[model samples]
Target: MLLNNKEHLNVSEYVDLNLELRNLDLEEKKKLIWPVSKSVDALMNFWNSEPVRSRQGYNDKSECSQLCLGQLCPALYTIMSDGLKPHLGSTFGPIANSVWQVVEASSQQGPLTKTLNDLVQKINGEDFITEGMLKFHAFVFGLLNLRALDAWFAYLCTRESILRKHYNDSSVLTRGRPDEPRPPLPRYPLIE
Candidate 1:
């Protein structure tokens, strides 16, 4: 019987499988287990084989991506908890380094400067984000959603602050600023 719509078993089946495995002797468990690299390769192959688009033009790869991400999160957490770093030659190192530059620049100007600066350092040196660095990817993925909202709020706050500054001092000159001159208003307008 199919445990889930997919060929794979669902959570309960996995639990049962785990219980069965736990009951096995050491030698039996060893025989059943595959190497970590084999598991990784299989997951990568699965991801690559998944259809990216359906006949109706809807995204089909989203489910694959979600499945991959689900596997990644726990793996990453485990890697981080174990204090292991990804191999030096992995492709993700350079990409993460480049991104760290942008994050570093943003850190200098933002509200979370200290936190961002610390994060930059964390991603530097031996802690670079590499293809094998699941924890780093997971951490960045977690941050991806908030980065947009943070940028938007920062823009609004900066605009409002500038307006207030101009309002309080008519002699205040806007230099190197992109915004067109406008009348100052309260940061939070009263609802009528």
Candidate 2:
């Protein structure tokens, strides 16, 4: 039986299929799995495909130009091209398209700094409007989340540096500099 009308799934049939899928044996489920290599190859090809690249239409002017994939547009276009739009329509559709507008507006700025500032402001502004009716635009935009990760990394590095310095100082007092180590480690040492 035809389970789809053009692209729309026959929901009742789809539910029945899902129920049938749940009753499958381990071997039957295993037969449905694609090989890992094929999966990876398919993903790589889709990510780097010509049409997706052309749709990105990136014109980076940042100091990290061309190398910087930090911008929002490319990431959105990559994941939401024609093939995936219908699937994402009800879910990611609202948020993605709303963020896309911020990307588009910020792209018009004369300088990279201005563009970034405008983008951030638009996303973070409480008054920001979108067709999707999304609230907390800043949270949805994900730039702030990226910045949080960066900040967390910086904190971790700082903590690591402090710990390394403490270790070196303690080692210097007990033994010597890291380069001028005197004693050999014991075979079954409890602590170094």
Candidate 3:
């Protein structure tokens, strides 16, 4: 768990070492440039991962926080990454890489990189790199490549609608709403 500002500053040397190594790993990852498709694929994987999908709260629209990339709320990345940490490590490399990949792939430098650059400075911060800072980077990265993120969200919404419709249709018999004949399940679009 991450500490608040005061507690983090007083953390032990061992904890500080681990945090340093994690930050270094993230720094090294930022150096690589990935294709937009590769980054999208990685982002989709992170989105579909059990940890992320479970927190989606998809049943109710009001519960939709991290459902789409457009919802770039500050905690979105943290919620997604915290869930992935057990699988992706403390660095949250897969998600971070998605952002870095987009940033590198961009033809023009995006303003969002400023936050990322700031975080680079904070690697040596007295309080050191906090989880919130990492998530902010993720947010900025998502912001930078919103076009790709939007495409994914569009696809996600379409897919969800199809799936929900299919479920409702299938449940017609069980729900005792058999006013109409049952329709076959719709084929999902093949994700490239």
Give the candidate number with the greatest TM-score.
Answer: 1
Which window of 10 residues has the lowest lDDT sum in candidate 1?
79-88
- lDDT of every model, 2 decimals: 0.40, 0.36, 0.38
Give candidate 2's error at residue 120 in angstroms: 2.9
- Order the candidates by lDDT, highest first — what do you get? 1, 3, 2
What digit string (tens of lDDT, one per residue) describes model 1 on residues 1-192? 433343555456556765674455334323333332344565567547745453355454564456446654444333222211122223455222222222334445456455544554555544445443443453345344345323532542355443332222221222213563644432322213
Question: Model 2, stretches more than 4 Å misplaced?
Answer: 1-16, 19-63, 69-73, 80-97, 101-119, 122-146, 149-192
TM-score of each: 0.25, 0.20, 0.19
- Misplaced by over 4 Å in model 1 are 1-39, 54-61, 83-192
Per-residue lDDT tens digits of candidate 2, residues 92-158?
A: 4443333334233333445533535555556546454543223223323344335542342233233
